[model samples]
Structure formats: structure tokens, C-alpha cells
Target chain A: MAPPKRSVPDSSANGGALSLPRQAGDQRRDPSDRAIAEACGRGEAWAMELIYHRYRRRVYGLASRIAGPEDADEVAQEAFVRILRGLPKFRGDAQLGTWIYRLAVNAALTHVTRRPRHTEGDEVLDNIPAAQTSARDPGLSARLERALVALPAGYRAVLVLHDIEGLSHEECATILECRVGTSKSQLHKARARMRELLGPALAAERKGE
Target chain B: MRCPQLQRLSSRFLDGDLGAERASAARGHLRDCERCQRAVAAEAEIVAAARSLPSSPEPAQGWDVLWGRVSARVAEEERADAARSAASLWWRENRSRLTLAVSAGAAFAFVLWGAPALPALGPGPLGLVPGSSSGGDQAVTEGGPERDGVGESLAERGARERAETDRQFREAVSELEVIIAEEQAFSDGARADAAGAELGAIRERVRGAKAARVALPDTAGRPSPRQDPVYEAYWEELATLQRAAVGVSDGEPGAGFRQDPAGRAPATGPVTGDDRGGDGPQGPGGARDSAGDGEGTR
Candidate 1:
């Protein structure tokens, strides 16, 4: 019995539109992120899981890039936990999807910071949950994941949001709670770190290609 | 442009964040600098490869089953919320009485922490007589502890120590209750686990719960010998064990470990069985102290 209403979402604050869950069927066209968020606030079960379904991959993607696959599912769960707990009181100042992205990024960053010695390889890969392969170049993808995990949490979050998730610097700053200039600086440093980590892997992938 | 200058704009160029003029200049420089070109190309590849990695879907086997976990968790959260609401309602209904009680409590706290500082309010400043200035020492010593053979100062000191122990005991018991409740919950979860890695995680959690219980000082129903954080943690663990039991079973839950129905635990589970109890919680205090000590070591 959530009262759905029309409220314009301010995309400029969060940089752009993210794929938020829309109402299904005949109700799809009119349901904005704000409407779905409002419905969620009103205690609609569909709205809650819809939030989960829509952001699952994006959340998993951000977490996998930053926290590695072994820890990504946990991070994603923590993110949803926060979102479910926080969505009830959500005031629509920003896009709902942006808020979710911010939660996921922050969760991923905290997980990375908590476990600094997260070793990579076959054993760690064994614990990773079910992942479907969309990767055209699995060799390059593996190398990039390794390199990404090597960056600092702050820098990794920014790089994931901007470079991997294809968010703008403004968007990265919005999610990371830093200035645009800081996001750009961190992105610069993260790229350098990636180059250092991926040098041999990059060459190997290229040679294999 | 110098390589350093071009390098600074590298992210901007990759993100297309630079102004059109600066982007044009960076492109011209990139045409001459092979190193910068390679850097740009690598950045692009990283982004593209990252995007292409398979999305980690919700595990089909785990999703339907874990959804049960989620529902259980959500229901637990709702129960907590309901409890909070009940507390809130109690506060609202009893606000006037609560205000009076709180005012009295503040006065009581003032009497505890402030009494020593105020000459007019509490224990003597070691100099003053209640009435006469000239006969101060005589009057101060007058009518003090003529029968008990213990001075009023010593009696007061003993009373303070007893109160402190009583307070510590309450804290320790509250903490132990939480721990026990959580242990029961963990056991229920372990029983429900399917084999493979999930079972491994449940076993790890069980080990962790055991480690938490090990933090207890083997005081074993001995009335909290000291107010230690370790004791507090174990008490909380017990309380959690109880809550977990209530969630899992209807027949004889936390009664398995904690013998006290009133929950007054200077208590223990049998030394051999982590989840079973005999006379441990109700046994002679000193005997359980020795027995609980042995179990604590394991």
C-alpha cells in the first residue's frame, strides 16, 4: 500500500542515470527511481527485492573489482543490508540508484581496507560464487582484476566507478565522498599502480591475443 | 607539450574530461610520445576488460536456500524493531514517571560522585565536627562504631567494595546471557547446513563461538570474581545462545546449557558437552567453579 507519486530525480547531483528498477508491465513507463524508492519506503516487499534484482550485477561488479571475487558476495550482501535498512528513510535528494552505488562502493572499499593481505590465485578462486562468463577476453579480464585489487581502497573505488563502471569523475566523487579534483588525482595514481601491477600480465595478454 | 604535462592530462584524456583545446594538444603530443600512447591504451584496456568480466549472478542453489536465511534475518530484524517499539511505547506512556525517576537517578548519581566533594552533603572532609568547633576532634570521634569493633571508615570501605562487586556481577551476567543465546543460534544454523564449503563456514563460526566462550575466566558461577571484559563477552555470548535457541526449537532450548530458569547464571554447561547441562548451573558454587574451570580450559 505504498503511495507512489511523481518526483523528479536530480541526475546532475549524481552525474547520470544508473539502471534503477522500473515497475513492470503497464506500470513501467511512469515509475521513476524516486517512485520506486518511495514505494520501498512505504514497506512494499516487491520494491525491496526489485532494488536487489536491479542492482545485483552492478553491486557485484563494483565489489568484485575492488574487494576481489572471494569477498565480493559478502560485500554485496553488506551493501544490500545497508540499502534495505537505509531505504526506509530515504529522502529523494539524489537518484535512488546513485545512493545504492554509493552504498556498494563504500561497502567494497571497507572490505578491501579490512583485509589488506587478500592473496590471489587458485585457492582464492575456489571460494568465489557462481559467475557467468560475459568476458570476451578472459585473459585480459583476469589481469585487470589482479591489478585493480592492488590499488589503495580509496583509489580502487574511484577507478572502479570511473574507469570500470564508466561513471564520470563527478559521479565518482559523489560516490566516494571526495572532491572532483581528488577523484581525478586518485584515478591518476590508480592507473599508475595498475600499470605497475599489470605490466607483465598486460604483455602476456597482448602476446596471447 | 612536455611528457609530464601530457601525463597529468592522461586520465582526463582517457575519461575525455579535458577541455577541447587541451585534449587536442594531448592528442598531438600522444602522436609523438609512444610511451604516453601505450599508457593511454593500457588505461582503455583495463576499463574494457573490467567491464567484460562475467557478472557474479546470485548462485541458483544458494539463492532459494539463502533466501530462507534472508527471510529469517528480516523476521529477526522485525522482531527487534517490535521490541524497540514496545520500549518506545513504554517510555511514552510512562514519561512523567520516567522523568521523576530520572530526576531521582540524577540526584542519586550526584550523591555518589558529588558527595565526597561537598562538605554539606556527604562523608566528612577528615576535619570537621558536626556541631562544635572547639570540640571538633572529640565530636567527630563520638558515637562512632562502639559495638562492631570496626571503624565507620572501614565499614564504609567494605560497603563500597560490596556495591562495586554487585554492579560487576550484574554486567557479567547480562553479557553471558547474550553469548549463550548466540551459541544456540549457531548450533541451529550448523544443523541446517548442506555439505561442501557452506558447512566449512558454519564450522568456522562454531569454532569462533567456542573461542568466545574460552574468554570466560573460569569463575564458574562464583559471583564474578572480577569485572573483566572477557567475562562480559562470554555472558553476552550466552544471551545470544538463548535467542538463537528460541528461533530454532520449541522443546527445551537454552535449558540444555543454562540450568537456571530465572537466568541467574553463575553457570556452566557440563565440562564434556558444550551444549548439555547436569548440575553445573545449580551445583554447589565452589564445585561448579572447579568443574567450570576445567571446561573453560578445553
Candidate 2:
């Protein structure tokens, strides 16, 4: 059997209290993110907690786009484990959030490929509030999620990193291990296909706005 | 203006990546090209929708669970690395002793099966008996006697025959002395015949040393030129005469004599100097005769 997926915690419950202590330096600091990376590298407990709290939502969102809502939690957890193991070797050449997001995308893809028939309903989409579903058009978010899931793993990874996460083409290239030209090409293709999938809803939303 | 070129630029343009010239050309082409313009708008909407999609809600499990899994993996990898390092250290420490044991085993095998066969040395042909010497009475007794007792009696007979053997040995010695005296007179004639051979060899050696010394180009000091061959030959002759006088002085009576048998009386005879006449010390005429005939070749 494939290894069990990791279970990442909900970031909303811990709020911003789980962030790392601020360092007095000239650099623009994400004290929480920096603390998590250093703690994970040193195998410290609080650092790991901060890392999980900081990246859990972003990692799960990436995993959900790639693998679906069902396996996203496990994929997110495994991505954190991988990050912890790779932390010492991480040279901080890229943003920690970008690196962790890439790891989450890869973990989700691996989970999907290993069990291709597994569906999104296998695991509940944890921490999705019932009120937000009615207040916002939860159906649009669901439709967008389904459209992304319908795309190929490579296309989905590019779309999620370049579009939803707002990563630049170069940053997407670093995560995908491709040239910027390739990243842009993949992003264009992924967006074109996604529009084809959600054409009616996008048209309706545009008309309503 | 071309459809294929327009379509290719459409992808880059939607991504906002078409360079200024290409983007302007693409926009100009799309303005005139309705079919291409529709495709460009559709691509733009897709990129916009993808960018605006809502992020997923966070998972229910919190940081504690995720941290636990990460810590476990890190710990496992560290343990594996430590084990590998320990194994490598063990190998490094034991390698020298292992090599020494292998070398010793190889040497032992060489001695056991790879050694060359040795030649046998028993009491047979070419066998050597320890302590055997000439003129010793115990020589025959020391070597094992034949089982028939014939070897024992033969050894006794050999011992009794020694007295008669002593008389014959003295006569042989006297005859050898006479022959030696005649040979000496012949040698004297040959010495006179070949008047300057010894002196010539000496002169050649001196000339060789002088030339070698000159060829070396003395770094210490300049050397005098070598003497002419005639002058060198004269000095060599004088040296030969001096050597002969020394030889005569060393060869006094009883200087070359060996011991005779105990019971033998002293034997005397006339000294025959007749064989030395043709090359006598009288003049150079006899020397020329000896040289022409090659009679006293030295």
C-alpha cells in the first residue's frame, strides 16, 4: 500500500498567534515563516507548529486544485513532512511559501497518480464553514475547483501557482523546474482549457457584475 | 497578417509576454482579423478567471499533527545517516589487520606447495665424507667398509705400501729439479733474444697514461710533453736490467728447494750448462741466432 497521507491542521483556529517571534533585522521579515523554517531545520517543536500554521491553508488549496478536496489534507501534511526533511538543504533561494506550495503540488500529484481512481469525496473538505457556502457563491468556487481538477497535473500546477497564488512566471518556473517560456506556455494552455470548462458560469458571472 | 503567426503570438499576448513590437503587430493583425480577435478575447477571459478563483478553506487537522509526521521523518533520516557513518568507520579501522592476515596466509601457502624440489645428497656417487684429508691413515677407515670385509683388507695393504712409495717420490723430485734447471737456461736465452718486449709493454702503458692525461686537459696545472719513443725504450731497458739483478739476489741457494724422503741420502751430480751455450752472455751474435731460429720463444 502507498504511505498514508499526512493530516495538516486548520490554520484559522490558531489565528496569527502561532507566528514566529520577530527578528530585529533590516530585511522585510515574515517572522512566523522564518521561525518555522529554522525550527524545522533544527527539528524544533514550536518551529514545526508555526510552519504548519503558516502554510497549511496555502498548501491545502494547492493540493485541492491538483488532487481534489478529498486528498488535499493528506497531501498537505506529506508536503510539510517533505519540507521538514529538506529544510536543512533549503538555501532560501526562493520564498519559503513558494517552496512549500511546490512541495504540496508535487505531493498531491503523486497521490493522484498512485491511486488514479480515487475521487474528491473520499475525504471531507475540512474546516469549510456552512455560512461561507451560502454567503458567497460556494457553487462558483466548487465549479472552479472541479474545472481545475479536470485539467492535467502539469497544467493544474501551473494554473494554481501562476493564477490563484499570484506567483510570477519565473517563480512558477522555479517551482515546476522549467524555463519561464515553458511556464508561460503551460499557464496559457491551462487557462484556455479552464475557460472552456467554466465558460457558462464565467459568462453569467460577468453579465451579473 | 499571417493566420498561423497571429495564432502563435495570441498565446504570448494573452500572458502579457509578447514583446512590444510583436504585441503591437498582433494587436494590429487582430483589429483587421475578426476570427483571431475572438480567440484572443476568449484566452484573456480564461487567464482572468483562473487568477480570480477563490482559495480553498483550511483543513480541520491543525499544526500539531503535521509537525509530528515531519519530526518522525527527520529523525528516521538522521538515524540512517548515523548508522552508515558507523559502518564506514568500522571498515576503515579493520582494513589494515584484514590485509595483514591475507598476506600471511598467502606466504604460508607458498611454503607448503610452491617450494622447489631439493637435490638428494646420500652416500653415493659424488658423496662427500667429512674430515677426509690426503696422507691421513684414517681416510680408508672413515668411509664405510664393504660387508664382505674385502674393503678392510685393501685399506690395510694401502697403509703398508707407503715406504716404497716414498723412495719413488724422491727420485721423481730429483729428475724434476734437473728439468727445471735446463728450462731456466732456455728461458735466459729467450730473454736475450726478445731484447726489448717487456720494456716495450712498459713503454706502451706509460705512453697511454701520458696521452690520457693530456686529453683530460689538466684543470690543476699544465703537464710537460711526453718523451720520444726511442728515449722511452732506453729508460725501459735500464729498468729491465735492474729488475733482473733483483731477481738473481732473491733466488739464492735452497730458496726453491722442497723436502726429500727421511731415509734418502743427499744426491749430487755435474751441473750441465751445455743447453745454455747458443744464447750465452758472451755477445749479441748469440742473441741474434736465438731470435732468428725462434728456439727460445718466450
Per-residue CA lDDT of candidate 1, range A1-209, in tens? 01121121232223222344554573333456666667766766665666665666677677777677777667676666667656654566656766777777666665564564665444333333222333245555655666555555666777667666666666666666667788788878877777666655565555655
Model 2 bad stretches (over 4 Å): A1-15, A19-38, A117-141, A199-209, B61-298
For candidate 2, give the lDDT: 0.47
Instruction: After the best TM-score superposition of candidate 1, give how far the Cα of residue B143 lies from its true spot, in angstroms.
Output: 70
Report the C-alpha displacement of residue B189, candidate 1, in angstroms. 36
Compared with the true structure, what per-residue lDDT tens digits does model 1 show for residues B150-223? Answer: 44342243234334433443443344334444443555534222212222343344456446434532212222
Tens-digit lDDT string for candidate 2 (A13-56): 24345654555772213344454556566666556656666666
- Candidate 1 DockQ vs. native: 0.16
Model 2: how far is A135 from its true place, Å? Answer: 18
Chain B TM-score by candidate, in order shown: 0.29, 0.27
Which candidate's DockQ is highest?
1
How far does residue B26 in candidate 2 sit from its true spot (Å)? 2.7
